[model samples]
Target: MTEEQLQALLHEMTTAEKVGQLTQFAGAFYSEQEDSTPVTGRIEFPVEEDMIKESGSVLGVAGAMKLMGIQREHLKKSRLGIPLLFMADVINGFETIFPIPLGLGATWDPALIEELQTISAKEAASAGLHISFAPMADLVRDPRWGRVMESTGEDPLLNSLFAAATVRGLQGKDSLIANDRVGACVKHFAAYGLAEGGRDYNTVDLSERELRDKHLPAYKAALEAGVKLVMTAFNTVDSIPATANSTLLRDLLRGELQFDGVVISDFGAVQELIPHGVAENEAEAAKKALEAGVDIDMMSLSYAHSLASLIDEHMIDSTFIDEAVLRVLQLKNELGLFEDPYRGVSLEKEQTVVGHPSHLALAQTVAEKSMVLLKNENVLPLDKQTSVALIGPYADNQDLLGEWSIFGKTDQTTTLRQAVQKQYTHAIYAKGSQLYERDEELLKEAIAAMEQTDCLLLALGEGKDRSGEGRSRSSITLAPCQIELARLAKETGKPVIVALFNARPLDLTELEPYADAILECWHPGSEGAKAVVAILSGKVNPSGKLTMSFPRATGQIPVYYNAYQTGRPLPPGSNERFFSRYIDIPNEPLYPFGFGLSYTSFGYSNRSLSSAKWDGSGILTVSVDITNIGEVKGDEIVQLYIQDVVGEVVRPVKELKSFQKVSLSPGETKTVTFEISHDMLQYYHSDLTFASDPGQFRVYVNGSSVCEEENTLTFSLVKS
Candidate 1:
């Protein structure tokens, strides 16, 4: 349908019909299934059959046949015959589940993440999904927030790269409705990652400068990549609920950012305004959200129950309703729903495409790339013929897909024991301990298995329900029983290889000393066990790095490498007692961002700069030579960081500007160059303007954030 056709349909819609277009609900509302997974809220709202038929979109309802049936029923009753948009939280993979987004971030290869998203798009589209609420562009600094698993990382530059890559992969290059593609919705618009106390849906208080500098870049990056939708955060910004905050949705998002696409409320966030004390009732909530530029109310009765009444009472303008409905109709037209509501979704396609062998192979590849080698100590790449004791609750369990893998089938998950057994003849398994429970008999059995085996492979961490939305943890350390299980395995005088199956970064300080090697296998999806085994068997080298910092203690909850310089800095070599220093633990994290190890070592050498000074619009080239110093072929991620010695505002200690993932064989050396334009030096100044000032800068090229043996060069930015 053309613009004129969409506008005509909008013009003919009644206030009720228009309100319906701006409303979204779960499949239960349409009498689809009683056991239908509630996408947002837990309560069962009394949804009329007519409302379901006239509704603009449905959430969490996938499957070619089911979606076709819903479209068939919805189109028959829709007065304007606008087809319902099918959306779901396809955060990582669809059927052939990939690693969680955090693990994808750890891969540090945007191309790999893009391919994962492309596979996700194809699988999701075949299942009849039109939109994926994915690539959760929230920059998470606090690992206590359960949803950190969904974020790329705490760095704006890194998150932005991944965001744009995801948009391109999900929606394709030209059209959003192209072959095996679906619309990408970058989520939690503002600073949802900065929830107070690291709690989900908590208050967020950020200054405008901090908001723009830290949290807003990823969303803007997604928009610039042509993402079709934006979802509002669940938290309040500046004491105003995000769902109804015009300052966020209107002045900042639609105004400053120029995001012309639809703005959606995150999972009942619209009606949450009432509980947030910003709205007196549902009517007031509906009015504020619609007026504030929220184009859709997802999984809430606020719009359906009170939007029309607000317009009738002159509390909200009818034009607001018209504008929101027009965007919905426009999306429908863009999806080609007006012509073919099925959108090529079929049972045959679902059968052939959902879990295709190629997709499974890609999932395994991504899973392999995402496993971070935190510690090796010359005990990794366990021999395939070695007798191994795989002891853990996850040893034989199939719950490898982390939280938000709604479409994944657990029966398809290959457990660690199964993968090990398939590869070796002398692999024994036992349940060492539960995720949060301790059983003496289980520990005894595990100990016996360890004694009988050459080595112990212990898997431990939070369960599926512990590290997603609404699963924030006060303490992020391993459970006491799991730690005890690790201790018991170590007591057996066997080389212990601890493979973690967690979501967020765990406090591994307690368990680190007990392990000969540690692998941060962050819930590596359906083919997760296979990937872990391949890496352990030396078939795949560990190349993944940490995107988010792993704090040494929970006291250092918001630790990251790119922290701002303090006015009262700690004495460099004195270890002064009066400076800004933690009394117990050091200020630095246990593992810094971009920190990962491999079986093979890479050495950086010959750092050089094109010039000492660069004009405002000039480009400077920074080059470094990386040599594969170890005796194996491997991948190395070369990172470039810059520090503004003096700025209008306090700058980070060092900001990640550019990075390149290079692979080389033993004794191979390659020169990698990063072209640094003036734009790379720009920052949100004290006056809130984004530009670079005339100042000295220090550039460093290294393998990780804590670059002890870093190569540095000094340069300057000058006004032309």
Candidate 2:
């Protein structure tokens, strides 16, 4: 439908139908239960059957058969014949699950991540989803928040790159009109990741400069990439809830960001405005949301129940309603739903494409690349011929696809026991300990199993239910039982290989001492076990780097590599007083961002600069020769970090400007080059101006964010 046709349809819609276009409900309402049975997220709305028939969208129904049925049922009851848009939280994958977004960030390969999203889009589109609230571009600094599993990482540049890539992958070149794609919704609008104390739905208060500089870039990048929708955060932005804060939703997101796409509320967020103490009741909730330019209300009946009355009572302008309804209608038309209500959804296509071998293969490849070998003292690349004991709750568990796998089937997932048996024929398996409990019998059985084997492969970490959405942990340490079990296993004098299955980073300071090798295998999706076993058996090399820092203690919650340099800085060898040093522990991260171990070593040498000075418009090229000195072929992520000696405002100690992931065989030398552009030096000044100031800069090229290599080059950025 064209714009004129959409307007005609809008004119034909009744006030209830227009309100319906701005409202969303679960597919269960259209079913026999109506309001009795609940759908996803357990939110039960008091939706009338008439409202269900006339509603604009369905919340969480997937699979072609179900979606086709619900959509057909909806159109039959929809008086204006406006197609009901299908939306779901297809965060990482649809059926063949990939690693969580954090793990995807660890790969540091946007091209590969884009391909994974492309695969995800195909599977989701075939399953009859018109839109996915995914590619969560929130920059998270605190690991205590469960939703960190959904975000890419903490850095603005890295998050921005992945955000754009995800938007491109999901929407593709045609931007969701294509039959093989689905619309991408970048969320949770602004910075919901900076929740207070890393708790979900907490307050977020920051300066306008901090907001623009640190938290808003990823969402900006996603919008620039043409994301079809933006989901509002549940928490307050500068003491105002995002769902009702016009300053953020209207003045910032829609105005400054120039995001004309539809703005959506997080699950039940608009309704919570009453409890947030901003709105008095549902009527005010509806008024605030519409006035703030929220296009769709997910699972909140506030719009359906109060929107029409508010418009009639002159509490809300009818033009706001029309504009919101028009955006919804436009999106439906953009999705080609008006042309074909079914939109190429077929049960056969869903089954054929969802869990295909190729899709699983890609998931395995991504999972292998997402595994970070955090520590290896020559115990990794386990010998297949040696008798290995695979012990822990995750040893044979199929619950590896962490939370938010709404459509994932764990039975179809490959378990570590199955993969281990296939790779190491003499492997003995034992369930050592539960995630948070101690079982003496299980521990004894595990020790006995370890005694019979040549090496102990302890698979331990948080359960799948431990993280994502509302699941936040005060202490991100391994369970006491698991730590105790690991120590007992180490007493057997066998080399311990700890395989951690978790969502966010954990305090591995305790486990690191007893374990000979540690693999940070974060909730690797359906093919998690296979990829992990492959890395252990030397079939694949570990290449994933950490996007977030792993702290030594829970006290150090909000640690990142790009932190500001303190006035009283602590030097490398400074144990002096009056410095910014922690009395109890070091202020450094246990494992810094971009830190990962490969099967082999790479040596950096002969770092040089193309020019000692350059104008604002000129490019400064930095080059370094990397050699794979170790015996095995491996891939290394050569990172380039820049430090501004002086700035208009204070800057981070170092910022990651660019990086290159290079593959090299033993004794092979390859030159990795990075071009630093003028735009790369731009920063949000104290005046909120985003421009670079001419200054002296130091560039460092090495294998990780906190590179040990002393290869540094100095250059000056002259004014144009």
Candidate 3:
């Protein structure tokens, strides 16, 4: 439908019908299905029967046949025959699950991430989902935020790149979503990641400069990449709930960022305005959200119960209601829903595409590349003939797909024991302890298996429920019982390898001492175990790197590599009490971002610059030679970091600028080059002006963020 036709349809909508277009409810409101996947919470508010037929969209409903049935029933009752838009929390994958977002971040390959999302979109779209509440662009600095697993990582540039890649992958590069693609909804509109105390749904307080400098980039990047929708955050921005904060949703998101797409509230966030102390009642909440530019109220009765009355009473303008409804209709037209309500949804397509072998193969490859070798002491790449003992709660557990994987089934997952047995015929298995508790009998069984094996591969870390929305942790260390198991295995005088199945960056300070090698194998999805065993058996080298910093202790909650330089800085080997340093623990993280080990060694040398000085318009070429110095072949992630020696405001010690992942055979060398332009040097100043200052800059190119002073090269940005 054209714009005029959409406006004509809006003209036919009654005040109640218009409000219904701006309202969304869970699938339960329309009908009940015995086989329906419970992906969302129960409907708390009473949804009137009339309102159900007029509702614009449905959430948390999948299965092509089920969606077709729901849409068919809804269209029969819909006065205008407006097709219902189907949305789901397809965060990682629909059925053929891939690694969680945190694991995808470790890959540091946006192109690969795009490919994964493309496959995810195909699976989800085949299941009749029109929009995916995904590509979570929140820039997280605290691992204690359970939703950190949904975010890419701490760096703005990296998160921004991945966010854009996710959008492009989901919706493709075209403005209109393809039949096999789903619309991308970049979520948590403002600074949801900066929740106070790293708590979920906690208050957020930050300076506008800090918010724009760090938190807003990724969301903006997603919008620039042509995301179809934007979801309001549950948290507040500048003390005002995001759903009703006009300054945030209207002035910032709509005005400055120019995101004119449908702005949907995150899961009853419209009604949450009352609990946030910003609204007195449902009417006030509806008025506030509508005035703040929210197009759809998801699972909230505020809009449905109060919008029509508010418009009739002239308390809120009808223009807001009409505008919102038009946006909804416009999106439906863009989705080609008017032409065919069941856009490409078919039971046959879903059956063939959901968990296809080719899709599973890609998931395995991504899971393998997503596993970071945090610590390896020449104990990895164990001979396939070695007697291996797979032990721990995750050994035979199928909860490999982490949080938000509502559609993924544990029965379809490959366990560590199963994968290990395929490679090591003499492999033994035992569950040392439950995920959160211990038993003496289980401990004895584990010890017996350990004694009979040459090496112990202990799978450990947070469960699938430990790190997603509302699953924050005050202490990120392993369970006490698991720690005891590690200590006992250490005393066995056998090499111990830990395969950590977690979502967020864990505090490994306690477990690091007992294990000879530590593999940060995040929730690796359906083929997680197979990918992990491939690395263990030397079939594939571990190439993943840390996107978020692993803190030495939970006290260092917000530790990151690109932190600001302090005035009273603690020098190396210093015992100064007055400096910006911790008394009990070092200020540095246990493992910095971009830090990861590989099966083979790599050497960086022959760093050179195209010019000693860079003018505003010219490109400066920075090049470095990376070689696989070890006997085995491997992949190296060449990271580029830059430091502005002087600036208008305080700058991070070093910011990640660019990265390239290169595959090299044994004794092969690859020259990686990066072209730095003036755009890369700009920063949000105190006055909010985005421009770079004329000053000296330091550039470092290496495998990781931490580099030696001797490796740093200097350059000057001359005045334009």
Candidate 4:
């Protein structure tokens, strides 16, 4: 309904009715603290039965979820009969847990991402949930943040493509799924990328160049996909809480980006502004948030108490309140809730549809494709007779399924031991130490097991709890216990094969000195074990590439391959300490962005540019030859990166313009070509126009994910 229509209808409501319309909660994520003390370190929101009766409607949110009995009772009690929007964090799965988004991103498969979102929405909507907080579109560079698991990785183009596809997928067969296809909520808007020290809810301060170039693309793509809800971030951008940033919320998201969706605060973010020192109390937090464009205040009753009075006092505009509320109601209408409130979901289907076999197949595919073969030193594909010692806590522990995995059954889930034990008769298992262990004796016993085996498959990485929301780590090295265990395995002279199960890339400098083979398995799900077995045994050759750059150390964070070159480029062996290059460690990442090793190898030829210059309308063809020089057949996600010789605005050293994943048999050769135009060359100018200037362009192509070999072609665009 229009805000005018909403206002007329709201004017007919009693104070209690008005209040009810504004209150929403997810009963599942909350419980009263024992001894009447509020829960510590858990999101807490208190709502009384009287408050329930007084509020026009209450949204059953987040953990509270949708329960048929409670929902019916609320429908019966509310004065205005306004129903609540039953919401949940429907990321990956409601019950059928899929790989996290970062894992999904590694697949470079949009159809798979779409399939996951479609299934999640159907399951969420079928369970009577109206909305899902998902497709977390934060584009970030700092891998130290735990929430990186929940997002598509760092490339703006890649993130944008997948973000849009996932959003469209979540809308489901139609607007509503069984009355359950849940609405998608793109979250943590503005510059949540500048998290201070890589911590959650830390301060975010970045330039507009960095913001638009590195961060905003994913949100833009999600918005373009017609995502109807955007959740405000926990962090501030330039000293202003994102939930209370007028430029970001009102002027940009609503006005410039043209998002007509409901703007909701991150859990307790509105109330948090008081602690952030931006607001004096819940009242002021509510006033500032609503005025700034926060529509639904998730979990914080600051809106229920202060917003109504603020409207009366003109401290905040009533029109703004109506506009926000209407956006929420419009979403309800879009979901077709007015006709049958029980639309997308039911208790029975929720039990059956979620965690079904078909969904598990998809989870398996994502897990398989996301595995990056970081390094292989000829000791892999362990023979069946080879006695393998599976050493590490994560080897058999069910908790390493990676983070943000929901409704996962650890018992039903496959561990590395289970997957290998099925295939190889000579596999021996030993839990060397707990994932976070500090003990030394356990490490020794594990080393003894390493001595007994012909080869060692060391499963090491963060636990499932270590890599989701609010789980940032300052030191992203292999936990000390795991490192010592790796050291012991190396000393035994056994072929040490390390399977890394992490949400984000960890610095592997210590492990590389000992390990013969390294696989970034991520947190593969139930099929995780099977996938690991397949890759280790050469049943599946690794093809996935690193979506985010791996830093050599923590100080080099916010480091990616696409940064603009400084005026003084690093002279490799220069003595100038003031250069952008680091003194202790090289400025380059331990592994270059887009760098991933395959079990087999391919070689690239120099790129041949078809034309040196062209008009904006024509296609520019650049062809390059690739030959499979390895003994086995494999696929290559060959990349093309471009650099503008000189531009009005400083451009990235290299930006991934286009890439193609191809297949080749041993000794096979093929010419892979790319078509370019203004689409690939044009970048936004300072004047807010996208223009490709007349200049020399450099094209690089490589068999792997990055173009290490450069071939320059001078190209000029004629004025339109």
Candidates 2 and 3: which is better by lDDT? 3
Q: Which stretches of candidate 3 lie over 4 Å from their true place?
A: 34-43
lDDT of 3 by residue, 517-629 (tens): 99999999989999999999899999999999999999988999999988888988898889999999998899999999998999999999998887878689999999999
Local error of candidate 4 at residue 238 (angstroms): 3.3
lDDT of 1 at 404: 88
List lDDT for all candidates, in order: 0.88, 0.88, 0.91, 0.75
lDDT of 1 at 311: 82
Each candidate structure's TM-score, on Cα atoms with residue i matched to residue i, is 0.98, 0.98, 0.99, 0.93
> Higher-lDDT candidate among 1 and 4?
1
Each model's total of backbone clashes:
0, 0, 0, 29
> Candidate 1, which segments miss by more than 4 Å at Cα?
34-37
Tens-digit lDDT track of model 4 for 609-689: 887767768788889888899998988988887788788888888887778888999999989999886778887777766
How accurate locally is residue 52 in candidate 3, as Cα lDDT from 0 to 100? 87
Which residue pairs clash in candidate 1? none
Q: Candidate 2 lDDT, tens digit per residue, 9-117?
A: 8888889889888888776676653344333367755678788878888877787887888888777876667788989888788898999888889999999888988
* lDDT computed for candidate 2: 0.88
